[model samples]
Target chain A: MLRRAASILAISALVLLVAGMGISAQADVIVIGEIAALTGPTAQQGLQERNGAVLAVEEINAAGGVLGKQIKLITYDFKGQPAEGVSVYRKLVQQDKAVVIVGTNFSNVNLAMAPVAEQLKVPVLSNAMEPAVTTPEPGKVNKYHFLAQPSSIEQGAIVARYALDELKFKTAACLVNKGNSFATSQAEAFRDYFNANGGKVLDYIEVPAGAVDFKAQLTKIKASNPDCIYIPQYAQEAGLQVKQARELGITAVVLGANTLGVPPFVEAAGSNAIVAGTYFINNVHFGDPRLADFMARYEKRYGEPVITTNVFFGYDNVYIIKAAIEKAGVAEPEAIRTALENTKDVKILQGAGTITLDPNTHRPVDMPAWIFKWEADGTTVPMTLMYP
Target chain B: MLFQQIVNGISVGSMYALLAVGFSLVYNILGIANFSHGAMIALGAFFSYWIARYLAVPVPVAILASIAFTGLSSALVELVTLRILRKRGQGSLYFFIASLTVFNLVTAVLVYISRGNIVSYPRAFLSGTFTIGNLYIPWIDAGMLLISIVCLAVLSYVMFKTRFGLAVRAASFSIKAAQLMGMDIDAIIQGVFFVSGTLAGVTGALLGVKYAVYPYIGNFVYMALFACVVGGLGNLTGAVLGGLLIGLLETLVSAYISSAISPALTFAFLVVILLLRPQGLAGRATEEKI
Candidate 1:
């Protein structure tokens, strides 16, 4: 008799929960979804991205939201896995009824979600660096996917240009993780550009992903005596490389991608002195005048200073969606897609200035990569900026 | 350069040796793999890191504290999981599965608690490098090599010269027979786990000092398992040999050959050696006494 009563109570609770969600669904608000790596190896970046987006939503609703309707964000954790990314994308589209999806910063996850986004006919804006996330084949574009940041090809070109033209590096060595598409593409692009621009590549070393020890590779690179070394890897591996390279007495100028411009990398290096002389190309500058208000608001909300440029990626993506929603003048997914394709001169954060989406490839057009150096005091100072 | 690479190999190999020896201890007597040893390693690292950071203790002292704590934790794991299974007359497969489950469970809990952040020690311990001729050796690598050697020496003395070691050997031969000879079987097993866990704690703490500390640092168990298998299962000396061989092979292969296929080449080499030896590098063929 008690068991039967308990079952009835449980059923009633579930019914009430569903009914509550249904009432909220009918409210005068537009639901946008985010799939991020909230708990995994890359959780640091994911959490920052979420915080940035949430801050934007709070500020937007405070000033009255887009299209005369308040914005509601529904976020799900992908755990930095490609399979989980796809499942969450499906849930965000089918069950949550999100008009548009802001996807993960992991290139592999974005690659997996690209096809799903097209089939579901919901546009996905991502900061994943892989160029293949937006363009799958030659002269073929994944129409439903949009990249908010510069792609790997563009980032590689910037690095190569900086090394060859600005830094005046004559000979370089490449240390790339072949197992990761992001690292592989960036390394290949850098190599091609550097060679074409009259710079010599001493040796291109391929390190398998997740192999922590790089002393052997660094020793080889040191023996070759390159003017600079390119380390196109995520922060953790890049940090390890930097630490080990210093230990092995390789004093070549170390250059890395956007992922290396975060606090986690510095922390992982154990001492800031290890990374003091290193250079990395990033998308956003925390010192930019445009980010003063955003930075203050972010620190006030999160009780911590901004750690990575991922914050800007998340913040800018929401504003991009808001612009599309206002231009479309409707709270429908299809209309938002059309408006996003025609997006132009929309400013939020990062890039050279205002963001303009390419009609042909659905990616940000001509975004500049900002180069920064890590000072001995553990602070990043802007060196210069490069555009491609 | 070659001498430096060799030194690097030996340093890395010693770490693998420490991990393999710790893993092999529980397996030798229990006749089952304790996959939870990996979790114990991660726990040791995080525990020492927390102690050193929050309590402002010396790193070496913090490491000693973590060793004791993890030793107790390992015995507790056995008290809850394997002991219950053993009481139920369960097979080795069940114990293996339980151990694997415990590893995953511990990893998940750590992820939740830490939010999956990769953190390093507040102060660098055993960092920087010094040059001898043309060879550069990081201080941490030398420290790890020294610590591993000292621990292995002490472990050897205990295992070969002590009364408890005699009991452990007897238990490995036959648990029923050991009990018949007036040994408390449960106590003996618990003691072995404590010793093994202590070793794991030391290894993990040193590794955290060498690299960085993260929840996934336990994934190094794959290297430990490989070393244990290639050396000879249940053989402490073989585990050390296997570790050194694998580490040296990996470092040399990556240095001279293609780094891209080094892992594949290492495994292929292991497979060839196994095919030739059949019973592993150190194992002797013998009939089942049971």
Candidate 2:
């Protein structure tokens, strides 16, 4: 009879322990994950992303939380590598139990994470400009990844149009980093658009990544005597190319992708004069009245002035996730994925208009790419906003 | 256009020559690749940049000071890591690994300090290009070429003419024989390291001016390794020849062929050459005395 009593006690304890585990697992907190290159060559942009997301989460949490549950952000540093990016995506989903994910400015990393997102049944909102991150093949969607910024396709054509219609450049030469899919996609898009629009693309040069010296390629471009040179690369290479181009006496108008507008590009160029008259296609519209408040709050929170467009991306992506979660009305991964697909008319701090993802492509639609010209004082002045 | 490309090649090749020769120096004596040489290169650049920017010293003086400091640091690295390992009777592989560890540790520290930002000099020096007929050459490239030639000449004189050079050469033949002849092996090894470090330092400073200063700027050591291997790993003259050839090939290939595949093509070419002459271009096969 005593042995039977002890057995009953052990069974009751096991049942209570299982019930407690379930209760704790269903605690009143919503988990979200952010993956970024927090410590690598692109850390500057990553730092901005982290700061922006942190600010958004704080504001949301202070405003009585989202769906009556305090939002908890789990951030992972991929260190700018695609392999690490995949590993972190798994950790965020499987380990952190996050319902929705955001971040990664690198196109390659985003591309690597898309398939994993689909398998994990989690939705990823990325700022990576590569169109392939959402649509891996033409007319085929990845069903999980969403892009918050204008794709490289739109930005490239906008740049080409601005060059030909606004600046009236007759001939151009394209220089791209072959190693970077982001750069190559933009370069190729520009080449296609320029050629289709009756502009002469004198030569398309694919430069190996990390080739600090560009005199050899610049000499060939100079010999060709094009009226303009299109450089689509990240800030480090962009600054070096412009500085070297000016040194080599290539007086052609310089056109670049969005990455060229960052402070690192200016810092890398050394003097503002070298970058003066150079224009790059960007999504940020500094003159937009909505940004004044955002900029002020960002500075107050981070103790540093805004330097890159990535800050906007970080802030906007979090709002995108929040909107999806509210629409879903439940902190479940599958429900959030479904809700994210139906997102429409969401407001965010980027582009010249509201953020809306195309239901079919999972990419931002009708977003305008603005042309920004570098001033003599190391500031970028917005010239005109163009839409695809 | 051809002349201009050739000029560009020479400018690029000269930088590689400085690095390869310095890299070959330690290898000739120690029979091991000193990977820390890359860190010394990065340290040299950062040192010059910091002095020139923060202290407001003249660029030339900054370069000299950086050269001295980096040389001493290189010697110190040898004294601490390799010297200790050698005293412990470690194999060549341990020395190589320890050198690599030093390189990685230094790079990581630089990354932490700089926060992964690429910085240029506060004031432009050797910037802008001057035209000679139809050929346009950036002043920085011209300066690098001139400095590299002068350094090579001085190094050649020291290695061929000086008593210290005699000891190094003797030690290279046989460390045991040199010791029996009353040579201090430790001192000779340290001296070689100092000389090698000085070369790496100047190269680093020039490279920083030409490009931008970043933690990963030391990756140029790959070019040095390639040149050393192609020219016969321990032959100084071979290193210079190999550097110029590789530089010229890279320039011409990128100019005429697809830049995307130029590096791959260059590596393939190196492989073919290596297969043809396993001892490399200038290496002489020497039998062990047993």
Candidate 3:
């Protein structure tokens, strides 16, 4: 009976913690719920996403939040674990009564939670471009599950065009980190698009996430003498890869995913390791006055100015959600979903162009991509706009 | 290509050797596997980087100061936590848990402080490269190999040639016997922790220069404890051999075979080696008294 009592107490405490911590989901206040990775190995990402969300939310609240009902953002940090994401989302939907759920960052969690969302009949949108998240059964696509950002197929096609046509590189080699859904899909997209666009891929290598050395990988690629190298990896592996590749004297005009434009990448490739000819999928331009103003405000809030496709999507996700809620004129779950489906030509504070979420694949249309270069002083400056 | 990979392996092997020596010294003498020893090493590694780059101190001064700082911290760790646990008459498992908690706490703090940003600093001591037989080995690699040898020699002298060293070994092997023989257990243990922590600091410095401090990257360092165990638990010389063997196997597997296969390969090798040579490579066999 003592043991059973202890178990009951423990369960009660857990339930309390979950409910108490859950952001308020009420009809009077339009509460938008987000499940993001706020801690763990990819903890830096949380800072960006959270801050961007704050800036967007703050702007909305300052100018009357969601048609005079203050938009309350209730976030549950997943800490980059699937189990945590699942638990957090369950509480967020059931306990918090969250009308709509945004993301848990990585596609794996979103894909896993898709069924749960469908069961609950809540609209689920994620920033990750993983194909499996959208079309889970390969053929059967769920109408409830939607993706706000361009899918990997669309993003990869733009990146490939930037590499082959705009840059005019005849031969390119791609190095992708193995076991990563994002890396694998982006690599496949790059390979497919490059081959289709009459460009040759010299070698495609998949290294692990925790690999410390890239000298051997660079040596083999160097021997192939590819003029351009494309690496699609997260900031962690890509940081070391960028540094080690330079240290080994492989200074080929390199192209990377949006991850290359982040802090870990700049901090890792400091002093001499930062190669000048490096280009990445840069959505934020330092030259544009409006982007500059947004960056200044972002810097004032976040203390460092770094923007990515993910953060832009994250910051923009709020306004679009707000727009949808306002259009619906009610805080109903189905109404919000319908409102989101109809959102068009909406200007998100963090993006260069207006993002329009296409209702079919649930991806944004006309999401432009750019090629940015790293300076010797460790600043990632916008080099050129590659594809729009 | 082969030579380069070997040089790369040996260079990294020096790190393993340094870490191995630190682990061996503490475990053999303290009768406790200070799991915080990895975080201690990482903490030491970044201390110098913080001084040299972050605080604008000279590299040499930063290196020496950080080593001493880590040593002091290690000693305080012993005084505040380990010593209290020891006084409770519990086994080393007590220290093990305390040390593990301390490591986790320190790592959590480090993550909180650095916010997971990988920081790098230039060391003037190791800044260039030399080419031999189509392999360009960084000067830092050669420096690590040299320092590793020098530290081993110094540790050997302290263990075999010094009176305090004898007391430490005696206290660990047979605490009652050593106490009856009038050895200063506290003094000896303190000395051992200091030496162990100092070596960890040096290893940490090498790490900061080699690879920028990534949060919780020493996770693999704890995994090296298995190497130490397979080397015969708490045997100093065996720990060294185990580290070298693990390092060589890691390099070879990554080069010749697939990198993914090495985790299984190393585990299987260790299990097989333990089965064949239960006493470990350089472990001493005990005599039967009953």
Ten-residue stretch with the least lDDT total in model 1 chain B: B281-290
* Alpha carbon deviation, residue B275, candidate 3 (Å): 3.4
Q: What order do candidates take by DockQ, descending?
A: 1, 2, 3
Model 3, docking class: acceptable
What's the count of clashing pairs in each model shown?
0, 0, 1
Q: A1-388 in candidate 1: lDDT tens per residue?
A: 9999999999999998998889577578889999888887778788888998998888889989986789999989998789899999999888888889997788889899999888999889998888899899878988889888888888988999999998999999999998888898888899999999999999899997789888878889999999999998999889989999999899999999888888778878777899998888998888999778878989999999998777887898999999999999998888998899899999878967689989788888888879989998998899887888
Pick out the ten consecutive residues of candidate 2 chain B with the lowest summed lDDT.
B281-290
lDDT of candidate 1 over B1-290, digit per residue (tens): 88888988888888999999999898788777888888888988999999999999988888899999989989998899888998899888998999899888888888888888788887668889988988999998889888888989998888889999988888888888998888999999999989988888888888888888888888877788888888988889888998888989898899999888889998999999888986668866633322
What does the lDDT read for residue A251 in candidate 1? 90
How much is the lDDT of residue A40 in candidate 2? 71
TM-score of 3: 0.89
Tens-digit lDDT track of model 2 for A68-170: 9888888899987899999999998886778889988789999999999889888898888899999999999988898898899888989999988988888
Cα lDDT for residue B28, candidate 2: 90
State each model's C-alpha RMSD to the native.
2.5, 4.1, 4.0
Quote the TM-score that chain A achieves in each candidate.
0.94, 0.93, 0.87
Judging by TM-score, tell me the better candidate of 2 and 3. Answer: 2
What digit string (tens of lDDT, one per residue) describes model 2 on residues B13-121?
8888889999999989988889999999999889999999999998888989999999999999999999999899888899899999989998999998888889888
DockQ (model 2, Cα): 0.68
